[model samples]
Target: MERSYPRDPEWEAMPDVGLEVWPHSPPDTAAYGEARAQALQAPEVEKPFSENLANEALDIPRSQERALSYRVSALMASLARLNHCDDEPTQADMRLIQEQRMLVAMQLAGSPSLQQRLTNPAWVADCWSDALASLGAIGVRVENLPEDCPWDQDALLDGPQPNGRNR
Candidate 1:
């Protein structure tokens, strides 16, 4: 003997109030393929005038170009010193080198022109040579200084002091 399950009479008597469902058909793949093929066959178009002008605006000015060149030179010199030094670098020296590297990295991230300059091997070699020469000159002067000589801070001060007194 099979037992029959009982259903709620009130629920069965209520009208079926359900949303209307629409049947979905597959998209027209043939039409999409035709359109894509047509787009691929289309001729290349030149950039608009305003777009060209915007690109030109991205170029660095001569003054700013020179300033970036100098900063890059200084960074290169600092790196060279860090690599070539016989004695271990002090904490302050390491900090300075790290700062210079970070500064150059940030600058390069912002400017495409500077990034382009770095791509030229000849320019890079020239900058490296200049850095080495500058470092050599500074080293020579530093080596010639007397170790026991006292630093006269007052003599180095040319203008009025922070305490309102004229030096």
Candidate 2:
């Protein structure tokens, strides 16, 4: 008796192969080389500092600016809620605050002017003072702040001075 093996019906139904032919001729090597050489010979134009700065500034669309403003408003709301609560802030609340701060920082960092402004300690302090004031104006009591809060407690309570300094 002969031994039998299982055969795949689908494979058996496939047509037998014949010689393969390319649909099109191979690319012309000389033309490719000439094009590549021309590309290599092209001069690289470097933009001036002012033009580059202007381009960078223009890269951020107005929609993105609106989004950043919206995010900042949301952060302020979160800060108000956290500050108003008498109970200690939960871990999630702290995380949200940190995340919002990081996002705002990242957005501000995108602008060269903002980046330069951030380097000024006084400007940063004033920004914090202004934020706290805004929260206070909205009836959000600026009390029970986290220990790691950036603004000075006394300054925040007294309100910002004319010189943007906490009295």
The regions of model 2 sitting more than 4 angstroms off are 1-61, 114-167
lDDT of 1: 0.48
Residues 47-124, candidate 2: write the lDDT tens digits.
Answer: 464455444434443434444455555565566566555556677777777777668666655532333434456644
Best by TM-score: 1
What's the CA error at residue 153 for candidate 2, in Å?
14
Which runs in model 1 stand beyond 4 Å of their true positions?
1-60, 140-167
Best-matching candidate per lDDT: 2
What's the TM for model 2? 0.35
**What local distance difference test score does each model get?**
0.48, 0.49
Against the true structure, candidate 2 has what lDDT? 0.49
